[model samples]
Target: MAGVRQFDEDSAFEQALEVFRAKGYRATSMLDLAKSTGVQRGSLYNAYGDKEEIFSRVFERYADRFVADARVALNKAGLREALVEFFVFAIRSITQGSPARGCLSTKIAVEIASESPRQQELVKKMLDELEDVLVGVLQSPEARAQLVIPPRQAARIIVTMTRGIAVMERVYSDPKRLRQTASALIDTMVRPG
Candidate 1:
């Protein structure tokens, strides 16, 4: 294989995603990407296009995993259990690895989405997927009998609370307290009125 360079894209994406997630989109430079990925700056540009495009790729990778996790959470037998699993998934996602990186879609949704239409659409897509799953869960037989609010409103509240937990995890490192708070909120939100 003449002139063929071999490299692990998943490994590169992991390295690059960590740097972007930790430092954010604007703070990370091409040099940083090259250094973190162990690839040369020129090669990085050649391989992944510009920094903006590269970031889009990283965001896509993150959304893929998040969507998959949300699907698993939504698969729980009980609505309460499913939503609880979702909250747990959100907390673990934000708290993954050292220094509490938080959710990229959540972080970038606030930080970058407002300014970039492309990013806004991306964030909305991820949220929309989760919300659709949540709506389904809320419409389940058990959840319907104990409905606190309409399915759309309930899903919105759940998604907002989920994002808030992600943001708060950076400030509050104690998982027990966070989970307790989430449980309380879930009970309140889902309680039949």
Candidate 2:
């Protein structure tokens, strides 16, 4: 009981995630994480190690949830419907709040990918997981019949375009524009049959 933490670890991680999403890895400090999380700085360090360790754990959780959500979105009755749902899910992630937080993975990839190999691998693994999910959906009989390109290629394109949408969401902050772009990409890559 002496070593048990009084605070909720998951709640603190969520709070810290919000701060990291808003400020990014380079700009966020341990003090900021502690303040946002409403936990003492010493407690935070003791509970989650340093900022990098905290980030790695938080990022893993985020990526896992994101992929699970993608799987759900791609489970529609039809390929077109599933792809639409998937894009909608992706769009919501980037445009959830005022000023738009964008994709944390995308932010990490662009901001700190070169500086930290561990962080870079995390981003890469997340993207790979997403692509694998897409490929699974695309390779289904319904999806394969509707797809103009191979499942692997189409999956990669969808993943790449989703990253582009993340950037565009920040620039335009217009969900409609992003949806329209996704629809167009779907139209081009997937047959209407």
Candidate 3:
């Protein structure tokens, strides 16, 4: 029989994800993955095919987890509360997390080339899905008519604001300021004056 594999797929993926989260997609080298996953380069290649494949898997996992959390928050008592929770979670994640940086998808979005049509499409799809979820929560037909902006566009604005807040938190560590900004954003979206 061949030698037993020391690292399982899930464990390997988690370690690889940590590296990706810390260094991002373009900066993370195969050697970094090998070191992070505690596997030889040959074994990593055998298991994951390549760095791109591994990055794709990690991205899927991250996106899925984020969407899942957002869904749970959406189901909570009130729309405003859910929005606050979402922004609070995002700010805390970006400001005080282990890596202490902005989102992986956002980081990749900056680096992805226009020539890479597939990556660009994937990013757009991801953002669209996020907007769809937010719109589903903000289901106000009256407001839609009054504003003359589709729910999709409104949802995009909310998501964009949350992402911007996360980026700001990465630069500024004042929790009170972040919380105030999140509160103001939710207030504006919900009670729009």
Tell me, by lDDT, which candidate is best.
2
> Tens digits of per-residue lDDT for model 2 on 1-193?
7689989989988998999899999999999998998999999888777999999999999999999999999999888899999999999988888777889999999999899999999999999999999999899887888899999999999999999999988788899999999999999988877
Candidates' C-alpha lDDT: 0.82, 0.93, 0.73
Worst 10 residues of 3 by lDDT: 141-150
List clashing residue pairs in candidate 2.
Answer: none
RMSD of each: 2.1, 1.0, 3.1
* TM-score quality measure for candidate 2: 0.97
For model 2, what is the error of residue 180's alpha carbon versus the real structure, in angstroms, after optimal superposition? 0.8
For TM-score, the strongest prediction is 2
Rank order (by TM-score, best first): 2, 1, 3
RMSD of 2: 1.0
What is candidate 1's lDDT per residue for 2-70, written digit by digit as tens? 345456778888999999898888799999998998888887787777888888888888887888888
Which 10 consecutive positions of candidate 1 have the poorest summed lDDT?
Answer: 1-10
Query: Model 3 misses residue 82 by how many Å?
Result: 1.6
Best-to-worst ranking by lDDT: 2, 1, 3
**Structural similarity to truth (TM-score) of each candidate:** 0.91, 0.97, 0.84
Residue 158 miss distance in model 3 (angstroms): 0.9
> Per-residue CA lDDT of candidate 3, range 27-96, in tens?
8999999998889999878777888888877777777777777777666556666677877776666665
